[model samples]
Target: MRTLAYSLDVRFKPLFEVMGSLHAYICRKSHKKLDLSPSWAQQVQQRITPELSDLLDGIGIDGDWKLTYLLVHLCPGEDAADFVEWLKGMAAGDLYELMSPYSNLFPAHMGDFRDRTVRLFQQWNEQYMQHVDPEIIERLHVEAMKRKQALPASDPFAFVDETTNGLQFAPMNELKQIILMPQYHFQPINVVSYFGKVTLCHYAARIYLGDEDFLTPHEYRMIRSVAEKSRLKILKYLRQGPRSFIEIVRHMELSKGITHDHISKLRNAGLLTAHFEGETLTAYSLRTGALEQIHSKIMGYIEQGMA
Candidate 1:
């Protein structure tokens, strides 16, 4: 058997968090209110400066919208100057090619989208750098460093398991490198992007800036996944060993759609792993280290006051 080779690079980037925070602010209303604790959301909202508020309001869209994809491609470095330089260097055609996926939301004229997005990003960076507390950045950096140091000695896949709260997995092939970026506002949320030979995994850090409890996106899903009686039964069944779809459905006594939804939630949460034997047969088993990972996270939060 040929072994696969890959590398892991982890670091803190202020601009990455800035982009995520901007996205969160612009789409604040679209988020399920219950996803974030009411007090925490309100506290973050209160901290938004009047100028920043107006900036977001002015650029905001009416329905569900997100500019993160466009912003991420334009991100050049960890500073405002780097972003400006990157934007300035890009040709109009290149910008159009990048923004094409989201073109429906933008003007038919590519230049208009490029110019407007660049300006919004510039303003967003300025307001973020001015108002965001320095302490939050420092805390996130510390957490990133801890994860970077702790990950190298463990299984590469384990890094994704823990960092994403079991939501994602390491690629089985053609994965050259993994870059980890930690974010505050985007906690409990993991965003993955592929560029060239590397995979960018942006995940929520275990940093609490003194307002409300923070849960990794995976943790939130796990908690919610087992909240119902049916889902709990699914877990109990899977805990015993691998089972086929028919076995699960029959045991749970639920419709295929409902059982599938529950299984998907568990799988996404990293609690269950699916093995496809063939086109018609799939087996589900509890991920071996899943519970331990959650236990470690909870303990880390309690003992270290961070995730």
Candidate 2:
């Protein structure tokens, strides 16, 4: 068996959240395909600042998904000037090599795209840096570090393992250094590519904006995962006992594709677990106490607001 050693670097940076939230906003405005809730769309739109809007206009929203990843990978600590300088220093070849995997999604003009993206980052830093709270960032970083250190011994992968079901990768003994970034925009978890020896994993932070307003990224995912009627029904069935995929489809009276999608959403949210009994038979069971834990958090959040 091949073992992959990993370490964590937890950071509370505004650039990551700003870029991510901006990309999410663009995705909503463009009606681009995203697996996010309509409620979140409304919240994000309300949170959008005038400066952010202008920045978006200057940068444009095309290929935002690609740009978001690039920004996270190239983030230069917390300094805005250094970040822009880093972007400016990159050679076209380096940019191309970094972004080539997403060539099909980006425009054919690589040089133009690189220049536009660098300008966008510069504009964002200049326009939005005032809104970033150093105190909040420090608090978030402390909380995130605590969360990372508190992961159960049985699961070394932590939130990554929980969200990805299990980490599946091509067998290699490469030293993987995982940087855990706390993001306010990207809910649950988002993974950037395997860049040399480093992998960037962006996880949602539990940001308490006010007594009444809190951002729980994982909770949002869980709520969204069970929102659909079909998905809710599937969860209900799974709560009874473990069921095979075929059995679930038959019981739900839904098409194979549809049932699979619902099951996948639940599984991805860590609400369900899959066990392969054999080469052919796979059974899925409700992740015990998962929903209850989420419920407690939600209720506590609500009660605190009431107080």
Highest TM-score: give the candidate number. Answer: 1
The per-residue C-alpha lDDT of model 1 at residue 263 equals 80
Candidate of highest lDDT: 1
Query: Compared with the true structure, what per-residue lDDT tens digits does model 1 show for residues 214-288?
Result: 565556666666678887788888888878889999999889998987886676566776542111225777775
* Superposed Cα deviation of residue 137, candidate 2 (Å): 2.5
Clashing pairs in 2: none
The weakest ten consecutive residues by lDDT in model 1 span 273-282
Per-residue lDDT over 1-307 for candidate 2, one digit per residue giving the tens place of the 0 to 100 score: 2233555455556666666665555555532223455676665445556665655655553455445565556666665566668777777677667666434354566567666666666765565444555655666567666766764433543344453442323222453566666665444434344444555556545454534435355566677776788887877888898788999999999999988878767765768765521112267877756677678878988898899
Error of 2 at 204 (Å): 1.5
Alpha-carbon runs more than 4 Å astray in model 2: 1-12, 29-64, 94-107, 132-136, 151-154, 158-177, 188-198, 212-229, 236-251, 255-285, 294-307
